[model samples]
Target: QRQAMANNSRPTPTMAPNNSLRWERCSMDIDHLSLHCRQHSHTVLTEATPVPQWIDDRVSLTQVLEAMQASPMHVLDTEFERVRTFWPKLALVQVALPARNVLIDPLAFADLGDLGRVLGNGRPWLMHSASEDLVALKPLTEHAPTALFDTQIAAALLGLGSSLAYQKLVQSELGVSLAKSETRSDWLQRPLSAEQIDYAADDVIHLQALCDRLGDRLDRLGRMDWLWQDGQRQIAAGYELLPSANPHHEFRAAYKLPLAAQVRLVAVLEWRERTARSTDRPRSWVLDNATAIDIAQNPPRSGPELLGKLANCRAFPRRQVGEVIDLLASAEAGAPFQPAPAPLDRETENALRQAREQIDALAAALALESSTLCSRRLLEARARLGTWPPDCTRWRQQLLEPLVQATLGASSPTQNP
Candidate 1:
């Protein structure tokens, strides 16, 4: 199926006369069309929107790479489908260069390692909400970019807003209204619709302009390093392949389980994680959280009983019931289970409150969002452990350490009445 698509091609657009700009239609196939432009001078296309070029062939991809090499930075975005899979399936990649915009079809090429290398070659990538895109690109690019500028994070740091949607940010920052009708369209289908192509093109088209305006604000605020720090953190998290070590902790009710049941829960969760990755299915499909918790709370005596418990779980393998029974038995007989940490005690709760107040004051002084500085979960962990959260960035820690220390000190048993 893919070979037929790869074999398809159309003639390249002719260049315009010197010192003149011209828009030419370039077709990748009968159903897929792209627009290319030829210009004498290199300038960022902010005022006039350009149609995205369709690059499905090696020659076209190479030409795009050459154009990218001459530029210091590029704006990037991706469209993917992850509804039924453990990993994101890359459908399309949109890139905005100084001269042109192009959409590369991942389904047409057997290998994209070359494109990945070029993208991760240390040149800055300007993206909005880059976490998922980074993960989607991992199969093609093994290494993350050395430098990244996430416009969403940059805006949040500047007190603009937190978790702002791409369209909203573009509208607010650049006064550009982008259509969102094709957001839920299926990208994996062959011969993507013209609306889908246009929507994909718009995703990265104005990213450079938005980045320029937000970046200047960040530079003036002296928070560009902070944005970079957070960007790197996002990259690290996105590329993480392993499931969380403490998967059970993700459930709010896991803390209520007895020590042995909690141990069983952890084992089951880890098994589910491994199974999901190996089978390329979602974790919930292998074993729903509620079902896992139920099984852990009430250990089935035999495979029949386990099967009965999983009657409602359509995706769980019926043949694995015996295996799961054995796993539960082993967990029950394993070494003494470490009791999960109890909920925050009164003193610690007070400390968390104090720490939050301090953070609010600090944020106000810095003119930054409090959540951007520290999340409540991180604060609770800090107050409970009397140490900085491991994920806390250096810049944030430097600004927040004194407040954390003061809060903990004030709540110490010796100091408290």
Candidate 2:
């Protein structure tokens, strides 16, 4: 049974300057299981004091899991590397429970399915800017947490500023300055440096207190529900593993291409996405965007021409040149291209402008960024489709639906065409 921490009124500990805290030995017991701190030395465990522990072995992981299972909420963060891969390489998993901060080594364990199961249990997870972290964690967790309280989302709802960096949020909420010196360190390297460990530990050390402050502010503003709804949306978007269905839409220059070339561009983009995912490589590594566009506009007739086009591109499969040539040939012989929806006409543009003004006024009244309440893209999409974006949250729809209807009308029959 998950139990909420009854007392959240703990003092926020002063962060060690420059993230240079030295470790001493300390020990504690949970349900009579002796647990020792791997990094920090604290004589007495308090709710405010973060006891950093390294979970490198199954035994340690079991202890950490037990502690985590008992907590109602956890402050979670991840350090990952994805410089050249489509998928994030999860380097470290940092989790903060009331008095314990854990640095779980994903490299040490081959499988973390058990850990993932506990994490996905109905209890809430406190995270800051959770989207990327959630993506990095999907390999282990397989799904988002049942409940998530993203500190960044909470901060935004309280008008603390949208997209606040973890360091800046910590500084703003707890008056603590954290160092970012080891941000670029190679987390896959064994025997992590003391500085790196310190940096990693500091990532989650203050999250509990930060979540408390932000959650309280959101509660007082009557926007906590908004934060939760946005958190769920963020989680869903983050964990969406498949490539976008309309990958061609991302290429702004594709619109200038002829209908046939545009169709080729769509096929090439889809192929690139699938290739990147299958090979665990980046889309650029498979085929760069500029090259993809060029090939679509002026496809090679033979293998040598294709080879010349891809000569400068590294990591692309030389053997796949024939395949790409064949693919382009098939696209040329495929059915006629269907043109995309036309750009907004002057009348629709005016309606979109009016909708923006009303949304801006509502955002100002709620002490939110206008874009945060409803982005211009979403507003424009509404004008084009004559319906609200399906992804708009309940709170946002409740506030903006009537205003949008008034400004843009209930529906526009000719808007989409």
Best by TM-score: 1
Q: Rate the local accuracy (lDDT) of all candidates.
A: 0.74, 0.72
Model 1, which residues run further than 4 Å from truth? 1-46, 332-338, 410-417
Q: lDDT tens string, model 2, 1-417? A: 001111212333643322322211133222211211122222221234544677889998998899899876767899989888888999999987655678898998989999998887756677888888888988777656755678888778877788888888888777767778998989888777666777777788877666556665665666766766787677778887666655666665556778778778878888888888888888898899889989998999998898888755676888788888888878752454444445678998888888888888988998988878988777776776677665676677677778889778784222110
Q: Model 2, which residues run further than 4 Å from truth?
A: 1-48, 332-343, 411-417
Score residue 183 of candidate 2 by CA lDDT: 83
Q: What does candidate 1's lDDT look like per residue over 36-146, in tens digits?
A: 223334223333444568889999999999888766665799999988888899999999876677889999999998898888776667788998888898888777776
Which candidate number has the best lDDT?
Answer: 1
TM-scores across all candidates? 0.85, 0.84
lDDT of 1: 0.74
